[model samples]
Target chain A: LGPVMIVDTPGMDDEGELGLLRIEKCKEVMAKVDIAILVVDGTLGMSDGDRMLKKMFEERNLPYITVYNKLDLVQQRIGKGRTREVPQDSIWVSASDKINITDLKDMVAHLVVDPSNGRKIIADLISEGDIVVLVTPIDEAAPKGRLILPQQQTLRDILDTGAIGVVTQVPQIPEVLASLAKTPALVVTDSQAFKEVNELVPEDILLTSFSMLFARYKGDLGEAILSANYLDKLEDGAKILISEGCTHHRQCNDIGTVKLPKMIEKTTGKNFHFEWSSGDSFPDDLSTFDLVVHCGGCMLNPREMMHRIRICQNAGVPITNYGVIMAKMQGILPRVSAPLLGKK
Target chain B: LGPVMIVDTPGMDDEGELGLLRIEKCKEVMAKVDIAILVVDGTLGMSDGDRMLKKMFEERNLPYITVYNKLDLVQQRIGKGRTREVPQDSIWVSASDKINITDLKDMVAHLVVDPSNGRKIIADLISEGDIVVLVTPIDEAAPKGRLILPQQQTLRDILDTGAIGVVTQVPQIPEVLASLAKTPALVVTDSQAFKEVNELVPEDILLTSFSMLFARYKGDLGEAILSANYLDKLEDGAKILISEGCTHHRQCNDIGTVKLPKMIEKTTGKNFHFEWSSGDSFPDDLSTFDLVVHCGGCMLNPREMMHRIRICQNAGVPITNYGVIMAKMQGILPRVSAPLLGKK
Candidate 1:
């Protein structure tokens, strides 16, 4: 259990091949999760896909709850029985109606390592009143009126951590840190801005990306960071697949298109070939790829990312996402993720 | 050859379950029809799916010219003997760029029934100067800026048949027909407006919906009509899936949401049950369902629709779409589709 819980879920019915890619993702999330919640549209009765997932849970021996989302669309907690294969404890929850939410909280709470047991990485990190600073860049793709779901979620989780989370814009981060009375417990920066943020943050402060937690949560932190190190080895003319879970025009600063390639070349001193695909177009035949670097997957579920991660692993191709690689390159990989390992 | 062209198609990559249904549909189309054109997306490059369709053509000895689409999106065609698998004489086309359209015309003209032959269906039905009255009801689901694709296509086919097609709104159909010389050669209508239009067309005059052409073009008239009759047998509380190809709401008559179920029950003389889903959701499991009703598939490619059709057929479930069933109920089946079929 860490102070942050990053999710990587894709939508049910996407435009193209991306929709199917999301299915691979669900499996990834289940494989690494200590506690898993399978969510369904509340208004729509449980679908066959949901049933299929619960059976997967039974096979994997992962504990799970069936969360009925968008309760605001429908009020009833329409229930169904667990498959003969799964545990009888399958639950129904609604995030929009706030119905059965307490049940979800209790399920997650139970998954948390006991306080006396001192098993949670997140729980251990909080020295009551510790101020953790979150650095977020306000890019145009960050929705027109509000923060993206992941950022809002991070804010809520910070509140749950019982620590003062001083949210600061990336530019204000330096001033915010200098004015603080105490050395901050942590500084989490976006993967796109990590290189600069790492230079400014002191050696003692923990730094990581939301993507890093997801890599750990989905069970591949060590391998992903190692794969990311390949950024240093990208030879000129090497093909790089910069994949994103969602779509956006003008992805500010060209993180996938321009910056990552520059960083790869700067760090490894290798000229690299780059092509970008956003929203569900990772080719199945990946034998031709030299390296694949992905986003933090704020829009995707852990299950899908892990599937892609596994794809690379199965193909003998190196695959890594933004944050884990950034953290590893900066030399704070363990200090950032070790907090969430829960004795394992 | 009349305007009709029955086609057999291949399956989608992940839609393995749809194979049997598509094969059945292909067989149904093969059993009828005067001509067939196998359309292929050229820019994307033909793969196994196209190969499978080619095998079907070979097995049936059906004469077909590959209408390669989206030529505008590709670089120069690699030229003859490149793939070795594809026909050397295949015509390149671009629906988007309107390139090589005459090649398609020449191909269809050569491969299809001899249009000059007195044995052709359209020639036998309407002389060069004959008038054809078309009934099309415009509604919200009707594309705001243009005519629906099928109706526009049917009108073009009618023109190519050398008959003057007088188009009219459904309510204005009676007035327009009254003013025409004698009875019009044919009467075509939107199936949703079948009831009112059926009453207006004389018993001897030809009448059909835009959907009927799709049914015959895809080659499954009898089975489609028969499967749709399953709606009559559904229990009051029975589950029926009314699926559509697109995500947008029906613009007029609230057809899928309100009208179709009512007509199903009205014709069944019983309170038949109905449920609806639009956009990529075609149920995989059908053991719980009594029947499946699909739309005419204005938005889906043959590859995807045939997959859904196959799922129902393989599961031993009856399946039919809007136009075929409406044609049967209105008793105008043979006449509307006569344009596509030549004498044996």
Candidate 2:
């Protein structure tokens, strides 16, 4: 259940005007995968494109399985009992005929590295039936009538581990804590409300933010913390980039555009030039920016977030997510980073 | 495979501050369904809320199957194999115990109104191995490197029906047709290129647009075509509403904002006031508009589109889709509507 998920790519050798773009896409996909599966046509055997794909996997030290499909056609040509020679450790199957598909599934399952070997949200810290309080602030920036993806995903993870998630807003935390029959195991809050919630929750209880958990899950949390340390070094008129993963109409009190910028200006006490990019458009050339502050990346896939992180790393720019930045600005970076470091 | 898809709704008796909105959502869902399944707790029997839900379903003349869950608890209370009174035609089972779940599935399959019994895309006209030509225009509005949803769904339908789909751009349609060993059974194009495609496709070969076919499949084609007839009745300075199911930055040559308006002005030679709405903000009150021209609605679900159509119908306003209007303006509405009507 804790196995890594697979990323599907397009047909590699679509030899036309856009073939190069498709190949470029494949290379990007290759950067994020730990293993690869090469599907080949049984009738046509392996082509040059397949060989190049295999080489790419091998160059990256990715263990891969070669799957020969359309076994029905081969069976029809040479009769059912006849077996043709295939690559060693390759799987031959017919999707339509239901031939050896289960074996292929088992092989894929066996190849997955344990995805939970690294940091986890709460499974290692708490056990079944433990109570975890989640503090979500209902503000102008919140989507109407629904919780955002990060909170929903974190709650789902806790449920999966058989833990009870007690949801409350920032204002109700004091009342919720008083009403609870037993002391809660941990308190997680939206980073925007960190200052107030940090003050409300007792120092004895474990506390964190959704963004901090996700940063460690899908991105480099240690690096994010290290980069956030650069916030105090910014000079007046230093260029900063603010990137959001999703684009929606900016509300009156939108956290990304309004609240975060205000916090940064207040903390640094220096006016800086700010550039903004949202939805899929991340600047490849990060050389111009003193710092890059990205969203918590709930809308983005793990691979895409990782790719963006690597791009920032390669560009030698200090990159930190919204939550990490806010936590650092609140002077709670060491306190929050303590819980995650133990799990790591 | 013929099972009726489950519609997961909020807890019916959510009697709290937002209960009115929840009830409104339920009524909207009820309008689109033929039958309802009321699941209740076995131990609790029928509550007032359950009775209300049943009455609502009955008022709409919807057949319902009452499913009493947690039968295991009831059995433990009353002793196993002892009969207890239940409503006629009611099912009692435990979900956690995996009891009578198959019976529930069979009931759902039996209740399905055979969704495909009414409208189909292209499967009715073409047989196995028949060739169909698809003309797509790669323009600025096109998503970076993939076919739009309608085109992808149509191509998939063709493949599912065992028909061959030949894909080409607007410029290559001529070469593709000439190079084909056998004449294609049909030619379909993007509605934006209907003028040129209608001219290029032979008179003998059946021709249609993606939007036209989708209107019939996902929406009301007959009503759409009928509403298109109302375009001639518009006067100078008449109010018209243009609604798109999704929003994007309108490119210089985008169909919805630029091309459609241009076509309307040229065809009618009467300037009209235009009101635009995009992305799920359909007006409930349409009395101000003379006509409503909507997108093909590939992004919208069938229920949502039908709800919008019903709103327009209730307002006594003529509502039509983009493809139907364009075909009518081009004087090809009769030709395109012919193929769909035979099946209708």
TM-score for the first chain in candidate 1 comes to 0.61
Q: For model 2, how big is the iRMS in angstroms?
A: 27.0
Query: Which regions of candidate 1 fall more than 4 Å away from where they truly are?
Result: A1-124, A234-236, A249-253, A326-344, B1-344
Q: In terms of docking quality, how is candidate 1 classified?
A: incorrect
C-alpha positional error of residue B191 in candidate 1 after TM-score superposition, expressed in Å: 58
Q: Estimate each model's TM-score.
A: 0.36, 0.48
Q: What stretches of model 2 exceed 4 Å from their correct place?
A: A1-8, A14-17, A32-35, A61-63, A81-89, A127-129, A138-146, A159-162, A246-254, A301-303, B1-344
lDDT of 1 at B292: 77
RMSD of 2: 31.3
Highest TM-score: give the candidate number: 2
lDDT of 2 by residue, B203-297 (tens): 88888888788888878888899989888989999998989987753532266778888889899999999888987577778999999999988
Poorest 10 consecutive residues of model 1 chain B by lDDT? B114-123
Q: How large an RMSD does model 1 have? A: 22.8
